[model samples]
Target chain A: MATLDINRVRKSYGSMEVLKEVNISIEDGEFLVLLGPSGCGKSTLLNIIAGLEDITGGDVLIGNRVVNDLPPKDRDIAMVFQSYALYPTMTVRQNIEFGMKIRGISAEERAKATKAAAEMLQMTGLLDRKPSQLSGGQRQRVAMGRAIVRHPELFLFDEPLSNLDAKLRVDMRTEIKRLHQRLGATIVYVTHDQIEAMTLATKVAVMKDGIVQHFGTPQEVYDRPANTYVARFVGSPAMNILRGRLVASDGPVTVAFETSDGEALVSGVPLSPESAARFRDREVLVGIRPEHFTMDTAGAVPLTVDMVEPTGPDTLVVFSAGGADVVARLDPLAISVGTKARFGVKAEKIVLFDPETETRLD
Target chain B: MATKSLARQRAMGQTFIYGVLALLALYYLTPLWVMITTSLKPLDEIYGGSFIGLPQTVTFEAWSKAWSGACIGTECTGLKPYFINSILMVVPAVLLSTGLGALNGYVLTKWRFRGANLVFGMMLFGCFLPYQAVILPMAQVLGKLGLSGTIPGLILVHTLYGICFTSLFFRNYFITIPDELTKAAQIDGAGFFRIFFSIMLPAALPIIVVSCIWQFTQVWNDFLFGVSFTSGSDSPITVALNNIVNVTTGRKQYNVDMASAMIAAIPTLLVYVTAGRYFVRGLTAGAVKG
Candidate 1:
């Protein structure tokens, strides 16, 4: 196992900058996931670490040695690609043994490793089959088997489960987690799926527009996003943002906004005295998660449901609040469309942000 | 019922399609059948018989004369030396050009560098130019290097011409391979050469067979380059066949000429029969959606 340190890595193609001064450090045996939307440079960062792409300016350290100038083979990293890249001409056994054979491992040792990998992946019967003859899920297992047989210092996975069906993706995700635990290898995984990032990563780096917006544990990033972009990008059914203004300044500030019916006050948000003095009666954005809203009879805000979708376990209610669309995850039997529903926002779950800068205020 | 008429109409349409296909097949095979029939007839029968009639007597005399006894100039060495020379040129030319073309394709598709597409475009343009336009300059260069009129000169010409098409064939096939495969190999600690040989080359068997067949036929049947480059008995069999049939003021040995033409075409016919399925598969594999 090895610790990977990415120090201020930047990438550009001619004049268009793709990655800007990105920095990430992973400890030994840590599962680090770089998650973002397409064209967000998450894959670029992973490629840089693997030495497949050269960084415009920065250094990558693998186990105390700078690997910025080293080739991918010399970096001692194994990668599983989204396409499963098995040698089509070779049988499953030969595909797994190729890396060992190239590295000049003895024939006996190559055979042993191939057998053990096949057994571990439960692919003993598939040893003689070619990749074209294998089903997609079986080919994926063979791709994983090929990587693990090498037993390299670090493992790289580039959306390796993106090609599988939903059920198979879930199964392979669990298999990958178990393999990581058993091997205790450092892994840098890239995926655009937020659920995969949350479930598989020890640390998640959420990115946007070629910059790291926030890097933390999944819970930390979900609960305490650094900015509005991070807040909006990390969650499904994304966080709701409300336009409002601060109406009072004190130890416990009150932010008030005018509903169609009347004015409503949201309390218990602690603000710095200096920020409070500047935004005494100024407008700011308030962010709220879907699950943070509760069904209370004495709720401060009354919203008319525009749509209701029941997803078996939970009901998603889409309603208009503060003249903006707000989604709430409620009990399946809670409400229906065109009904007047009252929801109370918790003090701790409410987030305050500057409307212009989009940074968190409190 | 009207449904019975609709079924009969569909059956009629299907038969029309098969009829058209059979007509096209006959159109393609007619000349080859005529040549075979002409070669089997005796010399007097060839001169006096109807072009499409069955021969009165089937004889091996024409075949024997074409193989060893027919006169080309004062020498009666027939077409043996020309056949030997053609084989010498075609085998090495096909092997070298296809091997290099495949390597070039592997590099261009997987190991992309700056100006890679420009180089590929240049190669494509090379295939478009008429061979006659470049033959003189090529022959001059070969003569200066002491390669003109030799088997090596013909081999060099064949390799050059074959590369443009062979590389094109391999490149188009390789482009269908997903980039994720190469990226995955890179992450598995494979260098450029390792990834190419171990991964890309093995998956390219169908296209390689296609390239070999293409280059073999092209070099084997080439008349212009062979005639322009070498003279005397050192020329390929096509040149000898042309000299035999086109001789003015001499009695045309129609039987011997037809027999020699058939002999000259055998290598390509054998190639087509052996790797025909792979050739069609390779050509159409590009159209198969990944």
Candidate 2:
């Protein structure tokens, strides 16, 4: 059974509506992530689920019961904040034990939970030290231990690793993934980092301008985004959005767009047959992930490389097509600035969106 | 040759700066010097000699008289009891006002409701009004409650006035604390008071120290409310100190009056000398981002 169901949730502050009617459901033990840029109402959704913020409309259900009126304590959930929010004066053991102590759990039970959580996060040695004495990563582990000791049915993470430096963020991301797998607890995490969304989420919901643009598996969102926004938002260097005309719609649809050198052609998966026929000869956007481009001597599209960015494993070639900069990931040895490179996007890799609405055509 | 002149020039500048600082210190300390010497002089020498001159013959008569035998209208029982009264009044006033202001500030910053800023502004408006402006109405209310001539009534007046400043202090300090702390506490299942005692209040130690010191100085030094609301044995040290200075019935005992003034000034001066570092910090702690 799904552990959480958000039905038609709408939030507004006065007349400024920050979230439109949004819906999502997370099955038991699934890691559901709300991903977006700032002001996309992702945190608002997280707060509403935690009962910290009231929703303007719609129902929030946890374990088949509406929790719209329940206080955060009554919801049987724990949250780790972006700031970690560890109590400044308390030691690590006391921090982890605080919630249980407040709930009137026996001292023996609290001690057992605290000990178990400390060992789980590998923070046993730092149990007696205050939060200010620990390093950033240790503080983050203490925050997680504070949440885990409660054994809540669900865990909420609000961009918990955002405060760390780069290398530490990556390490904590892996640690969080392992923790989830070990506990098999249902979790709903909110973050603006696409890489974190991609690496950790079993389900990713991409949000923008007060609405969820797409909700699907990470591969589904990355491979077949529902709109130009979702496609651009979920990938590093983002998906290349090329304005093109749908030249053919029969067996395999093809789009033709202008490159700096000349016109380029790309064969793509057809939209639904009924919709494909109507879009034939009409303007549409072709969304192609950077990794989908391949360098080939006989490739149909020729690109005049404006810039080359070498990123260790691969190099990204920046070129202009249809009045937009497009980035293509290529072998580090394959490309350089000011070179003429011919590239091909595989037929199955292109997704189509209506140019005016930015929505998927079918 | 160049290095020698440069060294000479640096020495000249340092001397010039220190010379100006010493002159300013002397200018500020001249009155304190006058008071100390006057308090040590015999009454006959004070009447016969230069005001700024050191006493030709020293005497301890005035310090003893000021502490034990000074007359304030009819009472010659001295300031000992009134000093205790000020301690009683100031302690409770400082504690109650600071406690209430912290709660007010926590609500104003974290558990905000509609028009919370407006409400805080209204409370802060109280800090700007001179206590004299509200005396008539406040005294009337105190009289109706039959608390007009009591230390508790005076404590009430000081607390009502002191809350405004303390509230502003806590609000500014607490706002720098991320709202995430409160949200995390709520998720931990702590209700209002629990979160305050365990989480927010512990982290507020610096601001709390600042608020208590600020409230103590204001209430301890207050005179207008003390004079207007209480009299006689029920009066605070400030009022009693005033009567001793301004209402001497016999010869104008300059040495005795100076001794009494010094006694009254000692507590506040001692407070500053001991915790002055914290006072400057408390004033400026939340102005910068944490």
lDDT of 1 by residue, B1-290 (tens): 89999999999999999999999999998888778888888878877856677778998888889888777776787778788989998999999999889888987887888999999999999899898999899989998999989889999989988899988988888989888778777766677887778787788888999999999988999899989999997888888888877762466777788898898899899999999999999888779736
Give the C-alpha miss distance for residue A84 in model 1, angstroms.
1.3
Best candidate according to lDDT: 2
Provide the TM-score of chain A alone for each candidate, in the order shown.
0.95, 0.97
Which residue pairs collide in model 2, if any?
none
Work out the iRMS of candidate 1. 1.6
Residue lDDT tens for model 2, B53-149: 9988889888888888888889897778888999999999999999988999999999999999999999989989987899999999999989999
Candidate 1 residue A24 Cα shift, in angstroms, is 1.2
Whole-model Cα lDDT of every candidate shown, in order: 0.86, 0.89
Q: Where's the lowest-lDDT run of ten residues in candidate 1 chain B?
A: B244-253
- Tens digits of per-residue lDDT for model 2, A1-362: 24999999999999999999999988989999999999999999999999999989999999889999999999999999999998888988888888898899999999888888888989889999998899999999999999898888889999998999999999999999999999998999999999999999999999998899999999999988989889888889899999888887586788888999898887766678876898889988888889988878788789899988899899988999988999988888655589887888776778889998898876
